[model samples]
Target: MMPWLARSIYRAQEAALKRPTFAYWQALERSQWLDRAAVEALQARKLNALLGVALAHSPWHAARIRAAGLHEAVRAGELPLADLARLPTMTKRDARDNVDQLVWRGVPGGAFRYNTGGSSGEPLIFHFGRARQASDAAGRMRARNWWGVAPGEREAYLWGAPVELNKTDRIKTLRDRLVNQLVLNAFAMSAPHMDDYLAALQAWQPKCLYGYASSVALLAAHAEARGIKPRLTALRVVCTTGEPLYPHQRELIGRVFGVPVANEFGSRDIGFTAHEAPGGQMLLLSESHIVEVLDEAGQPVAPGEAGEAVITGLSSAAQPFIRYRTGDVLRLAPDAATGGQGLHVIAEVSGRQTDFVLAADGRVMHALAVIYVLRATPGVAQFKCVQHAVDRMEVQIVTDAQWNAAAGAAVVAGLRARLGEGVAIELKLLDTIPPEASGKHRYVVSHVPLPAGLMVTA
Candidate 1:
């Protein structure tokens, strides 16, 4: 498809879906250049708008706003950014349990249901509106522009979603072509499949390659091992997300792809929060988010100090996640802006670590391969996958009332299907799954290490 035709189709799809993506993108393109004070002022306006929506629709947030004595201020649009601290921060549990009170089903453009990828151990089913969707899409467009990639340009996605992967119908394929996207499954990266992926990329010659950091890095490693050099001449950049991009992984990916590797920081819950610049600074989407770095006691951390990232999504009006505690630890850059841009800077982000699962056939797969299986199973409250050996896998699951013997069998069957028929599956039901000694929750831990030559350095 021609780029012009693809751009038209992309715009048509967004309009049909009632997502104000291009309009938001246009705003983002300009707002990114605003002065610091002006950008913060813009954030204040958006923040108050979000608060007004929460007060009018979300009972949970309304109560908190009232309790914090900001109801009048919200209505009057007088709430300052500093006053946001008065309201309590919400946890993942709170968002999960109080979804009904938090979501506005009748929100403009309608609300949609989504489930987290379960990187947090416990999968959260949440609702978001088209505005939130638009925010994420538009934010990415602005970020990609920083690397000279435009919307509707040929881009390849090494992403995985059961729904997307299962829909192999002609219409879905056509839609992908119309939007200039080629989605290769990150969940299925067997040696043979990776060879096909390399061939596909060489043929497609996408302007950008985007996907999970580990998956992309693994592909690069596979290419190096096989001495296969992909000829993607049009490829401008490799964008990595869904995990912290380690320095060595970045170096490996950049060298293998012959392009600069950009790391994107965000989560399924918070939408697109930040992106890396060519100069290597991670710039927050200040127009769409209010980010606060807080210490263990919930007090604001000094600049340059690491702390948990608590966020307020200004576009999340359908399901207001005001001051939502994202367990990821990050440090703010000492400077407020980089390269004269007003977007807040992040010095470091460290969390969401997923291990690689080695299959019995020696095919290296991303941990999400098994994670998708467990996450889709009903009655699973919390779960973890530990690969003890090539043929030994242990699953610890905390179940709800929906759990049954059949679900247990299905879990075992799913594990065997991915890990191999010869692998021993141990399903252990527990009331609670404990975190690591460092208090971090790792949903997938592989005791079986990768082969000596294939190990990805930290």
Candidate 2:
């Protein structure tokens, strides 16, 4: 069947089902128009209802609240955020260890099960119900609206996840076509495969583009080096997720794609949480999740201070994430004239805390720092860095269509320049870099311990 025909049929079926796409858009508009006070009040009410459900249904929360000496009548507005410290912060391990105990027994039917990417080194399986899933989808729609791509507009998704060309996937692909979306394979980012990607985008003529920041930036770099400027006139916005958007990357993508670039910060477990507004302000999606920044001692950090990000899901009922600890570091923006109702805009966010490469000289560097140099080199596709020993490092590369010794040389030179002399660097050619067991790619991996007293910055 023709791709267009398949998409049309799928869309018809979706419309028949009365999918929540339109309702979600209306809800997003309402939330965006809300004043700070109104948003907070809605959040407070939702928080109180969630707490009530948690106390009644979740064994884990019931025990924790009892241990903290909190009663069932704790109103959300009156409940101090600081008082949450009394209950232990939940982690992936805790969920994995107590999945059933964490779920709300009153939730009708079965729960929606999912696995974490183990980006921080431990994969966890979790469960949440239908309501949480719907809320998550609504939050994503709100972020897309920030880029001016509404429901039924053409958009391209360059995201991760296995592409099973089975019946279920076919049905989903058809449905997405009706909603005007094309999904490009994020796993196939090798130089040899990029031409196919560019061709797909040209054919699709999407109104907006969305994908991982690093992947899109790499493709943009490839386009620039090759002088292949495919006219993407339909493209109005380029949005990136899954990784932090560095200043250089953001600029390069905007220049190459000829569109304004927006950054979205989120996780699959919690859904879309924050989006960079059109005015260049990082706005927290306060309606979806309750966000808090805390120092090393688990105390609330002052506004504009850098600290650990903790999130509590207002929508998730199957697996209640009350004050869940996210491993990423972030800095909060100071209150400005833009209605600061104790909500801090994100100034900067460093990606996963564990993606640091340990150097032999006792220095730890962000994996992205090394990626900067590698991306500058021409004719390189996907690459991964592994530290074998204190003084030795190995780089795995998948080259462009015209693969040669030059590509390998570029990869070696890039690493040597960044890591300095006396460090042995080896480049190995690979058909493909395998994802971790949890199905997410890691740019860097280190076996050595980080130097003493070195801490990750937000």
Write one digit per residue (lDDT tens) for candidate 1, span 92-198: 98987899999999899999988775456887888889999999999999999999999989999998645233547557777997899998877667778889999
TM-score on alpha carbons, each prediction: 0.95, 0.72
Global lDDT scores for all candidate models: 0.89, 0.68
* 218-247 per-residue lDDT for model 2 (tens digits): 677767766778689988789888778878
TM-score of 1: 0.95
Model 1: how far is 302 from its true place, Å? 1.0
- Tell me how far the alpha carbon of residue 18 in candidate 2 is from the true structure, in angstroms, after superposition: 9.2
Once superposed on the true structure, which residue ranges of model 1 sit more than 4 Å away at CA? 161-170
Off by over 4 Å in 2: 1-24, 75-86, 105-110, 161-164, 336-344, 353-458
